[model samples]
Target: ILHPISVLEEEDDEAVIEKYSGSCLAGVSPKLPPLPPKILVEKVAPAPVLLSMEDEEVVRAVVSGSIPSYSLE
Candidate 1:
């Protein structure tokens, strides 16, 4: 489920650029079903690694109320 939110503060007369890079409506063509757009050309990039000696301590601190709500998770 997705919802789109637009700002109403901008006037309606303002022009907006709508460039369609074949992302949203690329794969629904009946004739082009076999050759759909190559949305992803390669495998997804790996996630960044979190490294720190106090990583476990930080989590424990958050769970034990030793830190504030936005401290760590």
Candidate 2:
């Protein structure tokens, strides 16, 4: 969203620079709308738990290509 005037000025293209150089000669630029408000978030921690022997067996089976690994619950 950069003004073409700024870019042309940087490139030193003075030929077309005179056209956009005047603001008071043309008219005032329109004001842009304000941005949305910032959102606040709270940190969360997962519950602590231990995996059963069956769970371990399922993991091993999946690793060994005996079963496909997917969500259990």
Candidate 3:
């Protein structure tokens, strides 16, 4: 006994279906705007020294308020 071989026919619409499917289905994220230009900073002078309270003066100021208060403002 001999068996007949069966062949499947390829659809003409397969190419069209593949062309419209899968990877292309996802939406692309919008491109972000370019960042602002970098600012050029000049060399700044060292900060000025404020009050220099001695340990004794600090103690006297806190205990008796005899020393003038140092303003941080």
Best lDDT goes to which candidate? 2
Runs of candidate 1 with Cα error greater than 4 angstroms are: 1-36, 71-73
The CA lDDT of each predicted structure is: 0.59, 0.69, 0.61
Predicted model with the maximum TM-score: 2
lDDT by residue for model 1 (1-73), tens: 2234353566342432242223465456666446666686777889998858697777777788998867443
The predicted structure with the larger lDDT, 2 or 3, is: 2
Q: In model 2, what lDDT does residue 50 have?
A: 80
Per-residue CA lDDT of model 2 for 1-73, tens digit only, reads 2344545444556755665565443455778999999898886888887889998898888899888666544
Error of 3 at 70 (Å): 16
Error of 1 at 9 (Å): 48
Q: Between candidates 1 and 3, which one is better according to lDDT?
A: 3
Query: In terms of TM-score, how similar is model 3 to the real structure?
Result: 0.29
Work out the TM-score per prediction. 0.28, 0.36, 0.29
| TM-score ranking, best first | 2, 3, 1
Q: Candidate 2: RMSD over Cα atoms?
A: 9.9
Looking at candidate 3, the ten consecutive residues that score lowest on lDDT are 1-10
> Which pairs clash in model 2?
none
